[model samples]
Target: MTAPDWAESALALLVHRAGGTAAQVGSRFPLYADPDDGRWTTTGRGSWTGGFWAGLLWLRARHRAGLGAADLLAASACTARLAPWARADTATRGLILWYGTALAVADPGADALRARAARAALDAWDPRLGLVPWGAALGGERLRARADGVPGLVPLLTSAGPTGARAAGAHLRRHLELCLPGAGGRPRPSWRYDTTAARWAEDTEPGPGWTRGEAWLLLAVADALLRVGTLEGSPTRPPNDLAEAAEQLLESGEFLTGPLVPPADTRRPAGPPDTSAAAIAAVALRKLALVPAAPWAAACATRSDTVLRHLADTRLTRPTHPAGGRPGGMLLDGCYDPAGHTAPSHELIWGDFFLALALAALRGDVDLTRV
Candidate 1:
């Protein structure tokens, strides 16, 4: 009946899926589950989404139902295993570290691992680009950047205290500059500064304005701004101007509730509706309302509630797998473009994670932004 009830359901399902997923895929990092066949794919620590399983466990155990000692140990093991990824060349180090380091900071045993990850992020700074390189190639020929990197990257950087503040500030500024300008300097989600070609290129999706990328960039910026406000003892650089941050929150809120009601991969009518994007936007908007300079807070809150209602229904939600190992996958019809081909449109792990997070925020389970 209420958001908490849905979150409670999701919490139970997460635990069920965690146990079964561990049995099915073991500790090798369950990256994805085939929506139709229910086969799990393991990508080890290299995959960006790999941390979500451990993240889900931590969120379920810490925020929702408490896990048993054995499960907590398993979750802790996953965090320890991810330590090597701190030195990984990609921008997703934050994605890998967020849940783990958040857990680490809470559980005093993880201090060294947290410090290691902080150094990895510190090493990612590319002064030429004024931010960390988006692609793993780094100083190599291919120079790439992405909107998705910020949401996952910034938190880990901020969590490092003053050590990461200067770099985090630089990254956010570069990210905004890279937001390809539409008519009248409106920010699009992504663009490429082709260092090799010496020209700027627009980063596109199925069509103009990748809805998910836009949501990630804009909402993530707002989330970053929110973090700058609430950080107690940690030293974090203040993000872009308050007016600029407000503009981003306003733009994101407007786009999310715009004509493309159930936002798809692209804003186009023909584009496949990505319920995952909508879910991400829902959490972003809800969290956006909490930030200092954000306007239309009540309106944004209303839109996020509407989005969650849809996600809670049969349309975006898929039933738990008949056999097991998958449960209450919240947002359906997700689009992921891997190098070789487009991954199937199914429930994205981050989608489910954010949707549950949104519900948690709405029901006062977790502080979505500050965490």
Candidate 2:
């Protein structure tokens, strides 16, 4: 079968396995299955949300590939009601809008879905702040600051059109200019709202313990840069500054382990490294590769491939929940409890979705019709 066929089949199987009806899965409730235990669970909540977007993207691709109106309508409806919370955040709202608009283009009967998506997108936008808030927070201050620059820029660049994208890009560049560390310097992963001090501060004292924080910043920026390239209709010519940032990140290589280890940190075996970070890094590299002449593109792609392979081979790509199971369940290695007090760490939908996306992108299988 073609890639589109494979994606369609995979999506169908995934929706079915989640216990959704064919119409529901194919229509507006793409990722809304309740848990098997009939309880609120976080296992499949994360990336599963993306499934709704993925389903819509897939349907549109299928139509482009010559599917019939009946099939298109079914997919459109499934895309419509999959996530009510799409109205709550800019990222999701943009995704729903993008998908919904595509559906409407293919099947005019999907006007309702398009309207709902538009309303959600409007609600997510914050005119006063000049940027869409991720969610309904007082001023979106917390969300904006927490997201830093990277995530905030994605929707603007990729999902939003040139106007919104340019505006958002300018805002992000200004924010980073003021807040980020000097060139060739490292900033804290993030800052906290120090109510008393009335400003943000590096959460941790100077040290090497901020690997994850750095990873987040690097990955986010790398992704935004890539999106900018794609948005500008110059997929092969990314911004040079963005390219440098990515190269700096790649050069860090803190997460990549050779055979040797520091004597003090010998207790922990660094055989495979953090699967999650590796996954994120793989995606970053792929984005950087959009710029064909990017000096670091080849190396980044090579490293990303290695990391992706390691992640897939290590069972990190396994579904968050087992097959033939009920909804609202966790996968074996799905969740993680940072506090280590309560909450079981089980396989989660969010992690799995990202892993799938990263893997799919790496394999040049980004056409959702295959996923």
Candidate 3:
């Protein structure tokens, strides 16, 4: 089938899957689901992945606007529920707040929440670290930086003001310097601060091979470029050089050349594939394609389409599949913490969000960059 055809089918299945998810999770957020039965392990407080759940609800609401007000009310309530995260001491507020509100059109509540999150993130910024600390709120080192912390924060910070824009630039630049030490290798996804020595050290847990690491950083770069491009070189703009840095990385990243869906960790090639990473990369590529004057636009768009198609055709569960007895539309084979043996092959909430987002983009239901 064609792009629209496949994307439409995928979107329909995902919407159906989301309905079941909403019913199952109720007020909580769905984290990941068992690949066999599509049963989700939920979080009461809308953890790091919670915004994706909220985002998926918004996406469904938009896709089915004509159906009724049920989806819209669900999306709004979920967005409102995320207010508590605005005060939480986590860099993931970027993920939680930005995605949670970006697509919420004409909702002053969402707008206020976005503004609150941007200011909160700005307050969390550290001049010494040049980025927001990964934060102790998540039970990690308070002075650590991770690849996952950078993506939505770029735009989130830029929303605050000129100072926030500069902070946004510095945050992304610092992460790029630490995570991507040089040209042509996997990204070091996390780094810890040596408080006594006042030095930063590469973190071992995520390591260089973590599948989503590169994708997360790449998405941040894409966001930086898109936001800078909008500025057109004003005095209040972020480091103009950031646009250049982002473009270069997008052009040369190895994640683009490897398998569309890579392993959870490159170090363990036989491990479960993280389709979530591929989905994240697909959305990033699509956003990159929208960058003005980006030479790689055509290639990025092509690669994005290929990746999304692969996910829809293979990884996404379907009711009609020969081995399928499970609910359809659940994106399977997403590895969550392969090293910890935690839900190594399951349906990740973020995986489902990005997949649906990509499909929505293909079907002309939403703007890829705006969200």
Candidate 4:
């Protein structure tokens, strides 16, 4: 089959699956679903994953635009549901606010929501810390930095203005300097600030081989690389910092080259693979491919297409059932947390979002660079 043949089918499956998920979850947000029965573990407040649900809805609305207006209305309602997260102190407001609103074009509500999130994030920024501290709104260390805090933030902060651009630059640079070591070393996924010592200490939870950590930080670097020229103020970091960060992440992400899907943690090679990480990396690579004149642009694009194809062939479920039943389109083998044995192999909401996004990009229904 051709690229579009598989991509279109996969996209359709994912969107259909999103419709079923919407019907079942209603107001709640899905985190991960059981691989066997398609039963979801839901959250009332949408947590950090809520935006991905909204994003999938927007994709479905765009995909079925002429079919009916219901999907669009559903997407809008879901975006509105994400409003309260704007005031949450977590740096993941980028994940919640930016993604929750980015794809909804000409939406006044989404526009207002994005603006509100940008300002909230700007206010949350700690100038002394040189970045938005990994916030405590979700219950964790308020002065720590994690790889998950950076991706959606780049665009969210840049939308605020030059000050925000500077903050965005500093945020990415600070995380890169601390989490990723020099000379192409492996990445550490988390760091906490020790006030007594006034320095950053590496957290042991995520370990060195956390697959999602590498993918998340790479996505952030790709975002920065695409917007390199916009950070114009006194410059917390060099302009080339973005490119350097991308290069480091590309070198460190081994799954980008092989296995397509990787273990939840590379430290345990025999563990279940996290298709979510691969999906995220595929989107990031597609974004990187859009960076003009980059030496690796062609390579990134090819690898991205290959990764998406591999997932479509292997991970994405087929749409053989009707919409009312346990419809297909679950992107399985997504390891939420291997150490804690939490949903070690299931269908993740973000996994579904990225897989749908990549397939939509392939079929020309959406722009990978923008969303």
Tell me the TM-score of model 3: 0.94
The regions of model 3 sitting more than 4 angstroms off are 1-3, 229-253, 320-324
Please give the distance, in angstroms, between residue 187's alpha carbon in candidate 1 and its true position after superposition.
4.7
Prediction-by-prediction clash tally? 0, 19, 0, 0
lDDT of each: 0.62, 0.42, 0.86, 0.87
Alpha-carbon TM-score of each model against the true structure: 0.83, 0.59, 0.94, 0.95
Better of 3 and 4 by lDDT: 4
- What are the per-residue Cα lDDT tens digits for candidate 1 across 1-371? 24556556654554455566677777687655666654566766637775666666565555534434666666777777777777877777777777555643255545677677777787777777778777652333235667767776777776667757667766876777766454434446555687668765776543345677767766666667667643333334444463365465456435554642344543444755666677778877777677654555677778787777766764343455455534444345666552223544665666666676676666565767655
| Per-residue lDDT of candidate 3, residues 210-305 (tens digit) | 879888998998888778743334434445466566555564445557798989898899888899999999999898888776767888889999
RMSD of each: 4.0, 7.4, 2.6, 2.6
Off by over 4 Å in 1: 1-3, 63-67, 103-105, 109-111, 137-142, 184-187, 196-199, 203-207, 229-254, 259-264, 315-327, 338-341
Native-referenced Cα lDDT, model 4: 0.87
Query: Which residue window of length 10 is worst by lDDT in model 4?
Result: 231-240
> What would the per-residue lDDT of candidate 4 be over residues 1-72, giving only the tens digit for each residue?
234787888888898889889988999999999987798999999999999999999999888878877888
Ranking by TM-score: 4, 3, 1, 2
Kindly indicate the candidate among 2 and 4 with the higher lDDT. Answer: 4
In angstroms, give how far residue 210 of model 3 lies from its true place: 0.7
lDDT of 2 by residue, 176-248 (tens): 4433455445443333445566554544322223333344455566655656554455655667666665555
